[model samples]
Target: MKAAITLESVTIRTELRPGDIGYVIYMHGDIYSKEYGYSLGFESYVAESFVEFYKQYDANLDRVWVCEHNEKIIGFLLLMHRGKAAQLRYFIMEKPYRGIGLGKKLMNLYMNELNSLGYESSYLLTVDELPAAASLYKRHGFRLTEEKPFSDFGKPLMEQKYELMLR
Candidate 1:
């Protein structure tokens, strides 16, 4: 189990321990399907990405933050090195955990981590369905870099890429 750090009654863990990966995958799969009508393909894609990240994991340049309440993970975000840039991934918060400033706190933690790692910029890929997250990204200085129709999940979804220059 990862050590938990409390922030205003919420616990945020920076380490990815055993069973954390499964929980992350399950949470994404279940939440996305219920919230956006996404199919299993999305979960499969997540699993693949997790596997790839595991294979090439770099402790010095990669991090995953898991947010918890009452010892249950309620949200998570990832920062992975991508050359000179950091890639933000799997940023999500359970519905019950929204609107309480946890999202903002998690984001701030992510940005601080990236800055400490010396990343020049950070980027993330997200769908248009997540207006709240998109708004948060925008508020954090991320600008839309690309948008395109993506059907990889068996539906016509608008995929967007956002980037934030740290320097």
Candidate 2:
């Protein structure tokens, strides 16, 4: 099922404003998955403390873009670009906002932006534990580039990587 959805036009910025105070918490709460840590060759169940998350965000806020609806943040996209390669460091939607195709909308916008900015390709890594997310990536012309076992949450988990060559 789908509903007509509207997203607030976001202002992309390289500067972190005062409103970014709790950004670390919001970003990491969804990104840190014991399941994902294991799949990426990290310790099983690796969880970052508030301080650690904040430090990371402080160092990388310039690569992040936030999505706000009606004055509330509902999602964000963290990007990393190097030469011709772009990585989706983080992408997520809060529970109340999931499954209305916002993800696809956000990705399409990002892809167009990246293309205009001269990126030739994009890639992302996710765990098999998140089949729905993997499927979303697949639906968008991403092809699996790798699958392997990794330790997350102190247990072995399967990690999947996907890539898309852009125009």
Task: Give the per-residue lDDT digits (tens) of candidate 2, residues 47-156.
Answer: 24323334644332225566776566667666566457777755766655676667777777666666766777888887777777788778878899999996554466
RMSD (Å) per prediction: 4.2, 5.8
Error of 2 at 131 (Å): 1.4
TM for every model, in the order presented, reads: 0.93, 0.67
Which regions of candidate 2 deviate over 4 angstroms?
1-27, 30-63
Q: Per-residue lDDT for 33 in model 1? A: 89
Cα lDDT of model 1 by residue, 1-167, tens digit = 96544357688888998998889999989998898888899999889998988887899999989888888988999898888999999888888778888889989988888889999999999888889999999999999999999977757899999999888
| Clashing pairs for predicted structure model 2, backbone only | 38-150, 38-151, 38-152, 44-152, 44-153, 44-154, 45-152, 45-153, 45-154
Position 95, candidate 1: lDDT: 85
On TM-score, the candidate that comes out on top is: 1
Scanning candidate 1 in windows of ten residues, the lowest lDDT window is 2-11
